[model samples]
Target chain A: MIGEARIVKLDNLTLLVIMVGTILAMSIFLPERFLTVTNFQSMSSQFPEYGLFAMAIMLTMITGGIDLSVVSVANLSGVAGALVLASHVKAQAMGISPGTIIFLAILAALVVSLICGWFNGLLITAVGVPAIIATLGTNGLFMGIAIILTEGHGIRGFPEEFLFIGSGTILGIPMPLIIFIGVALLVSLMLKKSAQGFKMYMLGSSPLVTRFSGISNNRVIVKTYLMSGLLAGIAAIIIISRVNSMRPGYGYAYLLLAVLLAILGGTNPEGGRGGVLGLCMAIVILQVLQSGLNILSFSPFLKKFIWGLILILFMVVNYYQTNGWPMRNLVRGGVKTGAS
Target chain B: MISKLFQRNETYLFFVIMAFSFFVTVMNPSFLTVENMFDLVKSSSGMAILAIAFFVGLLSRGIDISFPAIAIAGQYIAVNALIAMGVDSLPLAFLISCAVGTAMGATNAFFISSFRMQALIVTLGTSNIFHGALLVFVGTRAINTGKLPHCFKAFGHMNVLTLARPDGTLYGLSVFAVLLLFVIILTWFILNHTLLGKSIYAVGGNYESAKRAGFNIKRTLFFVYGYIGFLSGIMGVMHLSLIRYSNPNYIVDTELLRVIAAVVIGGARITGGSGTLTGTLLGVIMMVILEKNLVLIGLSSYWHQFFIGLVIVLGVSITYYQSKRQNRRNLLFTD
Candidate 1:
């Protein structure tokens, strides 16, 4: 437990340094635009959508699996929610209030996301397809379904109350930010304090051991994917509400970036290790870097290049730290790769 | 032997293709025509070639998502450089693109083998870097059909087999389809006859066992990725020539997944050390036929994506379960 805490703290310290240093540099270079309340508010509101996605992917990754279909699930769920809202908005004779429509929309999104996640899980656990491939298939299926339903067009114009979920502020703090915090805290608690947390970590670390220990690996993995879906649904709601548009191809760009953040937050692609606290920090760091770079008038392509470089650099350094260097491995009398 | 033969994904895929072709022909009599068949293979040649590259990656226990990006980048670089050199030689174009592709693929190899990181993320990072850098530094404008090299346009029109129709129109097998055959035969020779091919299978099956058995892990990684890069470079140029246009943004996004689907549907396991040439060829044919003839069979084109997804899931599932049934159950207790 002490070792885990120490390791977590060290990772947090690194993220903190990177975040603070980046903020300081950005403020110095582009203070007027980068250090404004409005800029901060916008950043806060924007990240919640993909931040939820990061959490979804993180859960699956912790199980030594990945859900590549997060973006498609988000879009599908958003489309589901949007269809409810759009149809009701058109049918004024239904006598449904705007509030009921928002609730119904949210419900539709949640139901679709859960089913998608469950399907992803069954594909992996029951059919025994690799997580990457299974999700890849589902990703196409979900995206195609959304496209067919929407007929390749975006559903736009939410009611004012529904729009508030995206843009509203509670006591001068943004609604999205608050919702994100609540969800983050709940996830952090789930990962850290719950017995299922132990099972997930165990499952990730050694599926063989978990299986022999009489723990149902299928149940845990399926549950993990289900949680992943729920998170994606939340992200869809946030995005659709904020942007006031739900389309078939929304959030595709976030797939790799979400994985990048998960890895940055100290999660292993091999499974059984990651933290909500670190993931949150990683999300904030990325959001700031994106906003800061925007303030400095960088092109979108350049931003992508920088992000790619950052991910590579981070992975290299993190790899060295986690696995130790070859020379260090020799000094410690460890085997090759130092993974075990 | 008979049981094992029937157990193959290729066998299942072959029957499915035959059935689908029957269905398509019944719905649209034109599908049975030689011209339509040639067109099908011609349109799918680039994909089949790329699917071979994908086969190598998946067999090595890694998925190379960056190949599409690398292919597009390589094609663009090679085209722009060739145009600058005032040359239109087809071989020279392939040589440049292949060289560039190998270097780019080798970059992925360098980071992955040296740092010992997960293959997916490293490739993801490199994919972004390569595509982003190309877009930012290189020009984004597409070279239209007329501006393309004369050799490329000519090659697009070249046919391996020609037959006269009663209406005096010509129809034949395409040169691009011949290229796919050459690629398939070449890959088959390498996989069946070379130590490098054996090493790829060994490494993919179990990295530790392969290393202990004296495989040069780094070399194996480099070769697979570089070879894939080499193949994609050719694919890039072939695609450019076949389409008679070069778009920097072409054959990316959903296109990459389609290639993956073809390879996977051919029974290539994501975990590695499986799949066959016959399966891959059939997979490519099935996907192409489905995509091209769906509208002719009274379904919207959008249904192709849905059906492709379904086939991938079903194919992988059936193959996995069949293979699983052959193995003994897991041990109940362990030391």
Candidate 2:
């Protein structure tokens, strides 16, 4: 039992070490302003958007699937909310009360997000399309709809009350950061203690086995994608609130970054393993690197290159650790058929 | 006999293309004109090259989403080199661009086959790297037609065959259209007649069995991805010539999706080992017709994406149903 516990925590320990190492390295090489309170506040505020996206991706990846449509769904959800607010603003200018409009806008965003998620679920489950392909199709579909709705422009002029959820601070902590923490805590609880999480892991490990156990894998897949969609919805709310605007192409760059964060956080791409803590640590490490790079005045293009390199490096490391070294065989040109 | 003919996915695709064309011609009589046909084929040539690349990769149970990025990088490098060197030789520029593309493809093949990583994710990471490199090294400036040699611009608009229309507009076969034909024929020959092509099919069909049968999996994978890169390089040059400009910020994101959708709609399985050049050609034509007609029929260009998405889902569903029926027949036979 003790050995098993240690094994379970191995990834967590590695992540913690990486996080601390990144912070120490950043502090040493960067200027003194890197560790300032204002810098920390800004970093915290920015990291949550990426963190939420990573969490959204992690939930689906744990089930041996992927969702390429999360960013599109988020953009669409935000677009829906923005439209609602825009119309409300127009009505308020004409002397209509805007009190309930904000709440209604939030509700509309969540509903649209859920519908988009359900569409993904339906495609994967009922239509029998592969998850990646299904989500790829929906990514285009959602983005196209968003473009048509916004007429290829951004919607802005959100009320202050709506913006407060994204930028407002409570007890010296940013609201977005708090929301990210709350979602992470809730997801950790679900994965560790919930029966549904058990089913999800089993499904990922072996779908046939899970099906034989009579657990309705289809239902679980739908629910998993739904949860991913819901997280994207919440992230959209924060993003729109913070930016004070929404566009059809917002958060386009975040898609790959979120995937990198999840995989770097020790979430296995092949599934049946991962945790929210590792994800949080990975997000923090990336945020620190990003912040440090900014302070050093590195080009944004270089940042993308670094992120790509890091993703590939971590994948290579993970492969070596999990499957043992295959370098010799690779050089010898020998076929190891069952290695994978 | 009818059932056997209908059983082939290509048959359905061909009919769909025909039906769609007929519908569009009815909606807008000018859609069926020879001038529009030439324009359609010219526009689709670049996409056709990429679709063939995607088809070959899918046939081998691998995917290279980085081909578009490779193409963009190739164009950036080639155009920048041409402008800087003041080289007027179009052939030399094309060769340089293809060389760069092949190098990028080789990098993808190295990581994928050596590390045994998932091809999709590996290509995704490499794509980011390539795009970033393009931005950093090439910058975001658009190289204009004025910087290109006069011969290159003439080559872009050169017609192999021309016919005078009643209204005095010349309808002609574009050079890129000819290139696309050659590529299709070459790909077909490689996939059907070559030993490497057979090996690729076997590897994608069953990895362990292929290895047991003495196939060089790494070399095959390298050739597959490298070939895609080579094709992408050619397409990149062609695209630059056609548009008369090269920009790093080109609409590559949508272009990649269109290629994938065309290949998939052509009955290529994402899982690998089954697809044909003929079906892929039909798929490409179908998509081009659909897109062109959407604008002709008074819909906004934005709706084109929405319709393409719908087509992909519908095509995949049809393929799924056919496969399900095939599986049921196999089960009955076994029992």
Candidate 3:
């Protein structure tokens, strides 16, 4: 409780401590079943997708923009990958080796996501549509295009080598987890060290001000969304590889959860403030909470209800920290009157 | 004159709607029928009501994704209570829905107004909370028509006007259309004539300026959100009557998106302080026709979501360019 109250001071290390403490506490609270290797392995596998999404959402949110279409872009990218990888796209007919085709599939998905992100960036920066509205529009546009192509059917059958990226363990660590860590580190380094990242923070704080400061606001904003799109593409590859199928209607479940996870990770919804460490911690906390809930057999609806309440609670906590406690003033006034 | 008309989003949309209807009619001659028009209005009444409600929130510089949840929960609670009391009166049910909805909206208002939380995030959180709580507390079993009261059934059947067909079957205009008209006029009067309405505009235009002007910011926010709740309640009852069924899951997510799209198409600025009832009605008409009568143009219903996405992107772009032009015109220096 004291640590939570101190987070109002906006110290990153304190927040990290709280997150680390939560993991430890939960372990102690649910030791016998939840602390096992299988449980840990399953959690490690599940969180990579969510963590990548949170990171993607975090990058966009850092620029005072949001990419609501990240899920759709992921689904679209997955479908793009699946189109090339699916057995129906005969290697014999195309006269291409399965190895080359798999490589092509990965490239195609990345290119598609880059284009989608560029499109989103253009809509917001060049067109001057607000980020929320622009992303909302593209959310439908991308999902609609994906649906049109796939007709809402699941595209299955990937080569084992490709599936290896999703399910295979590397030196006792899941491949997805390693990829996620690599991406997280790159994102953290970029945000903390790169000029473009500085420009993003400035743009988030105030676009007009950033423009006056000689930053090419549109370029920075576009690049932010573009990176966000790239991350979504990475998440999609992992998803299709893990699930061994790609479908257009597959990404809606992640949309809200991704947003929730990003907010939980301490990315301000209005933008300009976030860190990869906080984001990763948030992802771990949520994944652990989910695992704990599943172990306790909590219903999905109850879990949703709890997540919503926690989001609201955190929002309030954030508010009180920034603005000072209004209730405290009210209570102090009463205390003075009583003394008098 | 043409340039002046084209400068406004409303006129641009009006022209597009005209062209669209023309094409739809040329493809199928029955599109011009008054019967079809009446049917369009009647069928779209529920959506039109929600659009108007959505317009109110947008006008006050708030975006709400929770109205559908409120609409569903409000009606469900009201109907369930009515059923428990062994009563089946429509008016009482509507009143209960409004009360329940207003209460829910007040909770939203409390978070946003008191804490200055972002409307989108606050509503997003509330939407999940409201939905989950409803599903958790109340069972998700749908109330079928047989379980519904006679008043609701009668109201659902009630017509504002009736005309006999050549085949001797009567085609009647639904009361829902009249109700929609009433809601529109009521919103217009509130927006144009009432102090509370003007305050909404002022607050949306510039929050700090409105506060300086002595408008109670919290009060206005409370009213705006509470009114949304109140309207959602009414919509809930109307939906119950129209469907004559109470499904826990009805008109969520994409349906809400479509309404917001219609509102945007109608010329409601997401940043607030500018919109018109005529534009809103016209936008709703365009969406309804596209949704319901697209088969007349030999297209699949699957195409509508794509159209909606296109409409939103195009509509927002038009609005942005129009604002830019206006800004340029008002600029004193070339730089």
Candidate 4:
């Protein structure tokens, strides 16, 4: 019993170490600035966008599918949000309340993001295409649409009130960070305690078993995508509000980062495992690292360079631990006698 | 009947290529002029070379999305050596550039194969690394090789005649196009006739069985990725030669997706195994023609991506449906 308990304790410690390592690294690298309130505030606030994306993707990954198109949808939503707000500026100038306009803008973003996610889900389920391939196909499709809409230009001029959400804080807490925490809490409960969550994990692990047990695999797959899409919508809003501009090229940078966070946070890319709590913590750590590196006066290029190395290191480590190393052997063992 | 249908897979792609050629000629009028066709083939040669590299990865049920980033990095090293370091030797700089690309590819394969990481995830990570390295190498701007040795310039620009016209109208073909075709034919030949190629298909078709059959799965994967890297290295040299300059900010933009789609369109299933080099060449031609015509006919560049996506969806769907139908028809006729 004691050994079993210790093993359980180790599971949680993984998150603790990741979080602590990030914090410790930040404090060491930017001793004066990292520990300060201002930098902490910025770090916390930036976490929500990536954190939310991680959450959505984690849900789908738990069900044995990948959504490479989330970043593209986020980018499109950001641009769409800006385009909507820009068009409504004329109405705002004529004394329409700014709050109403912002509300509509967020609504537009949510709808667009959900539609994009649904599009991904629909194709994968209906056409029998694999998630990675389907998402990749749509990644190009959605990005194409976004680019066409933007004409290779950025959408700008969002209301200040919207910007405040991205940049605002309440009682020493940034709004985006608050959303990150709140979303993580909500999703953790949904995945851990909810029936739908259980079904998703089951489906991810064994579609046949789930179907034999009378579960709707298609529904589960679609719902996971929808959840991913919804969260991506929320992330898109945060990104737009924070950056104050939107471009078709917006989320290409964040797409892999989102996937890295999800995978490193312990979510299995092949599906059937992982939780949002670990993922949330991982995104925070990554954001903190990004912020610390930036504050340390590292050039953006260097930051990208180092960040990539770190992601690769983390991916390799995570992959080695879970997949048991020597991927060739894993493939050989798992796929015996199918074609060869 | 199924055998006949499978035999015609090559023919089907050939017809599609011809149809696209006809369409392009109709739209641009001068699209089929020898000069224009030669330029088209030359421009597409780089993408075709990279597509071959991409084909190897897809064949192994893996992906190498970092090719463009690797290409840029290779170009950066070559330019830096030739222009900044004042290296007068084109061959040396070119060789080093390819070596860099191969090194990057080796790194990706090592982590992904040894560490058991997802190929997509590993390549995605290294793609950024290569991108960052390029920025650092070029110092946030494009590197110009105008002052480099003349032989280097000729590698990208110099055209040799293959078949001249009686009227001296330069109806000859581009040597670069021939080089690209040679590479494609070599790839086809090796894939069709080599033990290594057969092992690759067996591994991709089913890794466990291949291993049980005594095939070295890791080694095969490593070779596939390594070859991909080598091809990218070659493509870097070709691209530098073709474009005559290297831009640090040269975004792959949609090139990676196109290459992947081209592989799939060429009858390579995403599930691995069962891919043909002939289909890949046809896919490359189809993509190049569509892109070339779209640009020549004055469509928005943004539309190029949209059409490419549409073509990929349609191409894959048609090939898949045709193959499925052919299988069913074979069963029906036999019964």
Candidate that would win on DockQ: 1
What is the two-chain DockQ of model 1? 0.57
Q: Quote the lDDT for A28 in model 4.
A: 83
The sequence of per-residue lDDT tens digits that candidate 3 reaches over residues A133-155 is: 88888887787778777776788
Query: How well docked is model 4, in DockQ terms?
Result: 0.38
Please give me the DockQ of candidate 3 compared with the native complex. 0.49
**How large is the C-alpha RMSD of every model relative to the true structure?**
3.2, 3.7, 3.1, 5.6
Model 2, B18-50: lDDT tens digits are 888888889888888888888888888999999
Q: What are the per-residue Cα lDDT tens digits for candidate 2 across A1-340? A: 4553454487678889999999999888765879888899899999888788889888888888888899999999999989988887687888867767788889989999999988888888776777777788788888888988888899998877788888899998999999999999999999889988988877877787887788888899999999899899999999999999998888888988999999888887766777898899999999998998889898878788788888888888777766656786675555555453
Clashes of each: 0, 0, 0, 2
Clashing pairs in 2: none
- When summed lDDT is taken over every stretch of 10 residues in candidate 4 chain B, the lowest stretch is B326-335
Those runs of model 4 whose alpha carbons end farther than 4 Å from true positions after fitting are A1-11, A92-97, A323-340, B1-3, B6-13, B82-90, B137-141, B162-172, B295-298, B316-335
Candidate 1 residues lying further than 4 Å off, grouped into runs, are A1-5, A90-92, A326-340, B328-335
Tens-place lDDT per residue, model 4, A1-340, is: 3653353245457867978988987778668887888877877876787778777778889998898888877877777778888766797778888888888889888898889888777766655566777778777777788888888888888777888878888898998888777778888888879999989888887787887788878788888888888898889888888888887777567777788788768787777778876676777778877887777678888877887887787776665554456877868877886656
True contacts kept of each: 0.59, 0.47, 0.44, 0.52
Better of 3 and 4 by TM-score: 3
Tens digits of per-residue lDDT, candidate 4, B25-49, equal 7876877877777878888888898
Q: Comparing candidate 2 with candidate 4, which one achieves the higher DockQ?
A: 2
For every prediction, compared with the true complex, DockQ reads 0.57, 0.49, 0.49, 0.38
lDDT of 3 at A58: 88
TM-score of chain B of each: 0.94, 0.94, 0.94, 0.87
Q: Which has the higher DockQ value, candidate number 1 or candidate number 3? A: 1
